[model samples]
Target: MVLAGRLRVYLIALWIVGSGSNIVNAAGPVAETSTATIVENVSYQNITALPWREADHRFNYGPQSLQFGGLWLPESASADNPAPLVIFVHGGCWLSAYDIRHSYPLSTALADSGFAVWSIEYRRSGDPGGGWPGSLEDVIAGISHIRQLQDFSVDLERVVLTGHSAGGHLALLAAQHNDLPSLDAVVGLAAITDISEYALGDNGCQKAAAGFMGGSSLQAPAAYEQAQISVDKLPSTVSLLHGEQDSIVPLTQSDGFEHHRLPRAGHFDWLHPQTPAYRLLINRLEHYLPEHTP
Candidate 1:
């Protein structure tokens, strides 16, 4: 287990840079952060610096211009032996400022690690058909459309939905609806669960929550109520992961939910494959969906 785990770090680091960065203590289970440190930082730019692969194919799920997804398949994937799917949704404070390109590295890394990945692109708060429930509707439609795609080699039975930041908020909301397609689990990475509370925060990302909702919690109480999510209502199968050092979405955003908190990780750490936080994410995926066999 140590050998395989350490090898992944080498492979991903080599791809990021000929850096060959090695994790010092990569044996046995990941160290238990029995009493983890909780920090806060504002810098968020790691994955943006790395070279990432483009998706193998792009498919549109709806007539709207922004409703589409990029599909990445592992080299070993074939019609006879399909790979389990990980549907990725990105976060840009629910705005069009941050698109799906930044997440390519994540999808690419996951594909290289032997899973089929689909990084979804949806209309954002700034777009015509985006904002509020519409952005979420697109995510639901995009996930459901995977059932109709005839080109990809994926095991629909072994699927997981995961999103970051605003996208994570959408994923969690979609999971609550009965219409969403079947999934092994739903993962929220630094998700903003309480719209009203988050809007009160000072960060740019936190302030943008109102724009996505079209008004402040007090201005649009109904919208905030409709969008709010509580841990008590979520299924045990849904997993939450957050970086205690996250600057954008506070770790308190994950409060009430059973989660894995990476003490040393920051917000963007989840996107960079080389970070220990990313390792925990991979471990979570493996726990939820193992390799598919023909």
Candidate 2:
């Protein structure tokens, strides 16, 4: 058992070092500097610099009039072809305070990279009928609503799902549902995979888990079970990217899954287009795309 445990730790170290090397190579001149220094030099202000699409269409997917919306950004689409689609979900601890607006930068960046982006805004804990099944339901509904975009130049077969934090958790969970369309790949950035473990911890987001689920795991075992993403149920080629220095969501949240760990990156680093973490994320996205795609 000790030997096995030691091997696991060794493998994790190798993975972290390998990921660091890739980040360094992708970061150019910054590769010569220390990881901490490179991270320190990254500008946080750039996240909000790019303006999102001025018009985002809102749709009511459910009966409560609790509408969900998608901000669509298509990279140039010709009459003969449609761009691939990427559905982005934002994270705000499953609360209304944190909406889809925070994801605008990342969505716009993806759009600029020659892809169509559908940034989703769903109901959250503070909203009436929000929480547990409601938030999850909204995500499923939003994705399903993609079928309604037939008129738009979107390649449905190449659709990918990407999310961060709470949204990451939702994206991962949504990928597991057989009812949803088969996804080409699912990318989670600092996602919360273990609902039970998260609710039991003392982290700042811990209490929000209870609020989102409506009770403790012990109090609502069935709900927690439904919300949790089992390792075996993950999409075949799921890519999880997380930061070693993230304080909001612990790295252990992605314990059982194969994930790439950035040396000194934080929770919000994934959202910034200028960070190495974002570069690694784009590489991962490109890896799953068809080779013929530009």
Candidate 3:
């Protein structure tokens, strides 16, 4: 734990220096207080192609044209019923090669279970912080877009955020910054929460992760330190889900995070299922989200 903290400090310094050239372009603005930071007059659409015909939503925010679109599934059992909302984030180690499609099954399942779902895509580094703070910024921008759609069958207060793999990290960041009345809970599925552990992977995965992060802990300390994805800053009701046998992102990251901060955890739940991690993720989610209950 001490090593992690020390490493975090070192990484933070590197994040500041190595990422100095890009920090201004990363997160558009430092959130003074967690509020629904909106990026308006933007377009949201079905940008996915071919066999899947998935929707990839986009919106213009700050300097960059934020991509990694979204698929919004609205509640349809009745018109008057404003259903709960769940935002799904796709994980691809924050690389360009991976997009939101990987999470379609989970998104669709949640939506079919009666929740208004938003499966989101965001810019990735193809290596580390996954485009520095751009990935994080995109998350903020996407949720803000959804929040503005008041006429939609979305219940702001009951909003839930979930993501798998690298996306799990992004989802945690979103939930932490979501001080909005609509925000409810956050769920991470086999998340690479402890990014410093990228050294544990094979050469390819290691290169992909480190390259995305902009180098190793010794090289890009600032980015790692600036990375707010860890449990050190997680929200009150955060849930960390890990596959007991997960080889991609070891269950140890989740365990380490919980070990570091166990007291502040009021509503936090960490469960490794005898079943798939996804089932456990959904099960925990169902208990908190009313729409998913029955």
Candidate 4:
């Protein structure tokens, strides 16, 4: 665990310094408290301690080569006892370089907690027919593919959509587009809510944002308008969680939307089961779970 943690820290440091240069961009004029001290005071643990437990099944949603594929984490379930489901979308700055593999630990942990998990992979900005409407379309299709799992003992009415980073953006967008009446709630971990603001900023994901949307908000006004979240269109309650010390995607990105801010937490802290942020997430999710009459 210690070795893995060190490796993760090394990798993250390299990523920020190497590929993710805009990770430290200023949070614009957003009102933020003094949490900068926490950045230096905090000690990060390697959150990827758990090995990747292979999914029970893999399902393909569309005909396109990049259009399909989802990892299913099925906990014990019976016809009389159907497990609730969580459709998880991963974040990689909306790029094809990042995929759903990084989220295995979270998916495994959630499944261990008794909720069936579907960690999905979709076409990203680099792939052909990816980005903009294509990526968004894949998210919607992936969530809807839950219906094909009728053979599995799943309670569709207790479904939840949880996403991280770019995936969080897709999750919120999917909730607006998909036809899931049973979507009890949407949980976004360090989610990107405002695309136009993000594109205009100098964040690590700024360039990818433009790429994902097909161009600048001005160049692709229709795409930005279509993908941006409209609170009025949300089908379920939205719960956002962001780390106070997150420099990659600042806490301000979640501004305008109420979110649970974790002190001394960083971007990937929510994915670590041992972190307080993850516990907070589980607690929030408990309210939406089906009650048992013991």
Task: Give the best candidate by lDDT.
Answer: 1
lDDT of 2 by residue, 138-211 (tens): 88888888888777777787788989989999999988888887688999998999989988877656678999
Clashing pairs in 1: none
Off by over 4 Å in 1: 1-43, 292-294
Cα lDDT tens digits, model 1, 144-192, are 8888655668888888999998889988887787777788999998888
Question: Each model's C-alpha lDDT?
Answer: 0.77, 0.71, 0.53, 0.72
Give the per-residue lDDT digits (tens) of candidate 3, residues 202-293. Answer: 64444566766667778988887666465556667777765443445555667755322222111112221112333445566667676643
Task: State candidate 3's TM-score.
Answer: 0.67
Residue 107's lDDT in candidate 3: 49
Q: Model 2's lDDT to the true fold?
A: 0.71
Cα lDDT for residue 162, candidate 3: 75
- Cα lDDT over the full model 4: 0.72
| TM-score for each candidate, following the candidate numbering | 0.84, 0.80, 0.67, 0.82
Off by over 4 Å in 2: 1-51, 55-60, 63-66, 291-294
Models ranked on lDDT = 1, 4, 2, 3
Model 2: how far residue 264 lies from native, Å: 1.6
* Clashing pairs in model 4, backbone N/Cα/C closer than 3 A: 5-46
Q: Ten-residue segment with the worst summed lDDT in candidate 3?
A: 1-10
> Ranking under TM-score, best-scoring first?
1, 4, 2, 3
lDDT of 4 at 33: 21
